[model samples]
Target: MTTPVEVRYFAAAAEAAGRGAEQVLLPAGTTVGGLLDLLAERHGPALRDVAARCALLVDGVLHRDRDAPVGAPTRVDVLPPFAGG
Candidate 1:
């Protein structure tokens, strides 16, 4: 089955994705890395480059581990490194 996930892109990630947010239908039990891969394929290489250094905020929790599995009806924030304190 497919799970619906809300993906929000910020800063450089937003620029790469050309949008601030989107709803993606992902396979059940999809890993963080898998999601990133799918996004790269959908958005192209620019997003791939930014996503490599980006951090994922899953359901309000910060996640850096790519192997982590994402659950359904989740909100994923793609955050790129920012300047300033």
Candidate 2:
């Protein structure tokens, strides 16, 4: 069985997801986009859209592509765009 990964959401993404974070067990070799899809299904449409526009982080490092590979028991963070002057 695959290990459970901890996914953290911030700002609007967190509110939309209705939770600060979640722990999920993904099949081995699952792509980052696949994981987002799973989260969208679990959190609902609002979060799904937010996730689409957000940046992803793995273990505190930015994730550049949806196809990036993530192992089990990883720490994933979803960060939405922030506005500032």
Candidate 3:
């Protein structure tokens, strides 16, 4: 059965998404890249690039690649590079 995935955004990413997080239902065996596309379509182009470079975390573990496998009820966080003093 398909499971719901939680997409979290931080910093500018959050602003682009217009919220801190969202819950989406994804088909089984969805890849990280696919999820990013879904988020970009929902958020917009500006957020799409950020989402592409942003780190992905599944169940609190950092995903290594875009092809990484993601399952239902997954926790995905979009983290943009931080430049602060």
Cα error of candidate 3 at position 43, Å = 1.0
Predicted structure 1: lDDT: 0.89
| CA deviation > 4 Å runs, candidate 2 | none
Q: Quote each prediction's TM-score.
A: 0.92, 0.88, 0.85
- How well does model 3 score by local distance difference test? 0.80
Model 1 lDDT per residue over 1-85, tens place: 9978899999999999999999999899888888899999999999999999888898988877899887764799998889951
Model 3 sits at a Cα RMSD from the real structure of 2.1
The collision pairs in model 2 are none
Best by TM-score: 1
Estimate candidate 2's alpha-carbon lDDT, on a 0 to 1 scale.
0.84
- Write down the worst ten-residue block by lDDT for model 2: 64-73
Error of 3 at 47 (Å): 1.1
Ranking by TM-score, best first? 1, 2, 3
Please list the C-alpha lDDT of all candidates, in the order they appear. Answer: 0.89, 0.84, 0.80
